[model samples]
Target: MAEEDEGPQKAVADPETYRESLDAWMKMQMPAAEDLRVHAVDMPRATGFSNETVFFSATWSQAGEQTTHRYVARIEPPDGGLFPIQTRECEISCELQHRIMSAIKDSGVAPIPELLPFEPDTGVLGRPFFVMEFIEGLVPADVPRYTQAGFLVDDATPADRERMVRDAVETMGALAGLDWRTMGLDWLDVKAKGQPSLQDQIELYRDYVDRELSGREHPILSASLDWLDANAPSAPVGISWGDSRLGNMIWKNYRCASVCDWEAVSLCPPEADIGWFVMFDRMSYDDFDVPRLEGFPTREEQVAIWEAKSGRTVGHTIDYWEIFGAMRFDAIMIKLGDRMARAGIVPAEPGISIDNGTTDGLGRLLERQGVSL
Candidate 1:
């Protein structure tokens, strides 16, 4: 039998415990009221990235009435699957999602599940984590897996899939539509945020690849870099969903409920987002999937879509960033595979509970998923 979860506990073996830990913190954040009802907010299970994830039911009492609800918390990895190892005091990579989501919530682009709190107290749980609203609708990824086998829900129809896809794309446009400068996070120190250029991105990945892959040689790797260098996209970078793949987008009712896992958000080539969608969504490549550019629509098609949606002629050649982003995924995963003692490994979280669940049963760093719902 699957292990039963206990009070605001931790799942260190997994990453999702951030949710539980977050609730624990929320209990403190919200002032207890005679009119408020609160009970054991336990997390069950949810899946994304290499973190330990669990969902739970909540009941808070108010004015002799009970308020029941649900929400999700993202904690540090109890296992593995975090990537792009950096030797620094703080990581821009790790905190990317937290910062951007906070901004998006402020910007009013798309809906975001309300954030409760984030904290890292080993004494409380086991590691660092945050909490957010639990989206109760049919999260796109689960419907197919939990609902059927080999039915290929992915093949249901382009219309349903289109809603999902449109949401993903439009979310990008919605975000890109924002003015970063007005947002106040527009310009960050290069040292802190790293250079927001194709070259800076390339060098960062190159270093990541050399250290993680032990400098493993792949012809495609060099070809990809050479291609990006040769055919670099035009400059003045806006926000790019560094990992804007299908899985990163959270869908509900055939439309995007939230664009999440902002773990890869960065200021790089605007086309980078479009390119990443092509590599991961269109080409059916996992993080490691690299595609031949000739078969896909011309760079013009992508620019047209972005320009039409974002209302700006941002980039006409994102093929470079697409190739770069795909390679980045491969390099990160290769590093993850190296670090994991088990198949899944994640960053260290203080006091986070570790889930010793059976392999991939909890969907930690899933190897197979699709762009369509």
Candidate 2:
């Protein structure tokens, strides 16, 4: 929750100003006015932060008829972090989107919307923003505060929920199995200096955690770091979705249409992803009484499928990352909670929701270590 004592370049751009910039980008990108027609452009009321995402309706009128279109726009935030949750810059995010969609093009992976266009320069949208064809239908698991309100109360049928979960696992498995090294990305430079290998990634994240939370100390976090260092998997890192979880993949018609927010897709061990996934499910203690998810895959079934394809085994060290994952999410939640209290950006949360979420996550982590939360 503490502000960075040391500094990195920070930029703050207002939403309204950002939108105007994006609209200008649309105009420029589609300079052929006759061919391009935009009907309506709108953003969500309560903005979400996965990226500076906004929704817009585009109507294309060519020659005689008008065709309606909808799109989701995402841009980099004004303030950047040394090693923050936003993950990658526009370059990596765009590249991942391209590659993943390419892989799933002909498959039953549910057609992902195509990227209409993007501009890397901050000149447009005050930062990089990309527009993609927006797919219709409910996300299935959402706050359901807006366009998706009706489905929120549906009490999803068992068959539909199972299909959605299976689809998610299949899509992710396909992605992790992808051969990303052939993308000529060996020449692609990562901003983090030491990223020639997985060890570099592990060490970098560990160091960042230590430095960022210099004043705060968690014994489990320290233990997790040591455990990972001592047991680095020798297998070459594959495409690991840095933030692979059910929440990230939304269901459309009992299928996952969008596998998104690829700002963190990178080379990492298959176990790295499975461990993260397993721990995420474990963190939720996702047994019963969960609102958004009715019932989903057990960690065993998901791991079995991934293992059958990858031929890898998960061990003790990964248990640490799972704990660390909880720690990472916990830290974020704590920061959000603090901001809610200090700045009153949303509702000055009296620290209720995450208080229990963190407690549960910690309990899961401690259980892994044969301790109690």
Candidate 3:
């Protein structure tokens, strides 16, 4: 199998120094343990662009017995990462992510890793980070495109692929149906006094693109934003897994083991998440020009699964949200391309971000809707 560019690396420069600091921090968090040692501290290569994810194991002796615990720490990037680290309307991204995951775990609406208390003291690792019990499962790889290769294509039977799609969509639907207020997650609602949540989300992305562009123009993104504002759908607000996609899920036995990546969680209509799910499906297969592996549900079939589980009529709202999803994704790609250039992972001129498949797909979607950029 051929490997694709994994994008920029976010690992800390010195693992030994970080390990020592993390070991000390663990000692403070686990006071009762004797001879506690942190080892195998490593920054995983297969991680998203938003946070620096570190995996490590700690062993401690207590009551004359030794216990080992494996953990994954999500550390805020000092550079504010791919998105703005702080915004007036929301908490710090890492802190917000932790709180959202905790709330979701409490609600029991979906599966999440067991979370530890969030540590805000930058002294621990030079940045705020949260720890969670490490989950072991196969995650669909994004590098080579899962639709083209990997477990889903090579190992999974057709029935297994069907089950995977069903479970994944059902999980997304359940999340879309969550009562944010009841779950104490209303803090995720960042809309102004009378602004619709969907509009607020669009504005937020608009602002993000503006800041990322820093005076450059993304005409496609700008036009898409206008279209979203003009054709925004009216729907009930619900929890949105901002970056919903199969690649973000951990699977075991063709069932979703856990939904990872909460950095993009927010309060939006169910269509926000549903749209992202389907849009990503298109990106993974259609945009990549890879034939979707047999057994996976069709785009419409997946939406039907979501409708059944969420009890919400998708109707034509999907068309609107799909455009919105593509816009958001393209904006992120812009930021990603900028980050990669600044880090020298890729050249800055003629950047890969602006004219990539994401933007192309966005253009096609917009053109299909008779919206011109």
| Best model per TM-score | 3
User: What TM-scores do the predictions have?
Assistant: 0.71, 0.74, 0.91
Candidate 1 has an lDDT of 0.53
| Residue-level lDDT tens digits of model 3 in 40-129 | 988766334567888999999999999999999888765555643223534556787888888888889889998878887675776778
Worst 10 residues of 3 by lDDT: 1-10
- Candidate 3: residue 334 lDDT (0-100): 87
Which residue pairs collide in model 3, if any?
none
lDDT of 2 by residue, 1-373 (tens): 3544533323224556545655566667666544554445565543223356677665555668766667787655433311233234323354345444544453443356777655566545545556777876555343432113345336566667567667766666666565545543442224444245566556656655565445665545555556556655566666666667666765667777777666555555545666666666664445333444455557677776666655565544556556645644544554445444555565643453245456465555666666532
What is candidate 1's CA lDDT for residue 125? 52
Question: lDDT for each of the candidates?
Answer: 0.53, 0.55, 0.82
lDDT of 1 by residue, 1-373 (tens): 3434433334454334444544455567666633333344455453434554445545666677767767665666544335543223225332445667888889888777787655555455564566677775444343233123222143435456545555666677777776666776643323455445666677776776566545455444444445556666566667776667556656666677776776656556566777666655433423223342222333355446666787756553454455566666655655454444333444333101122221111122222221111
Q: In terms of lDDT, which candidate is stronger, 1 or 2?
A: 2
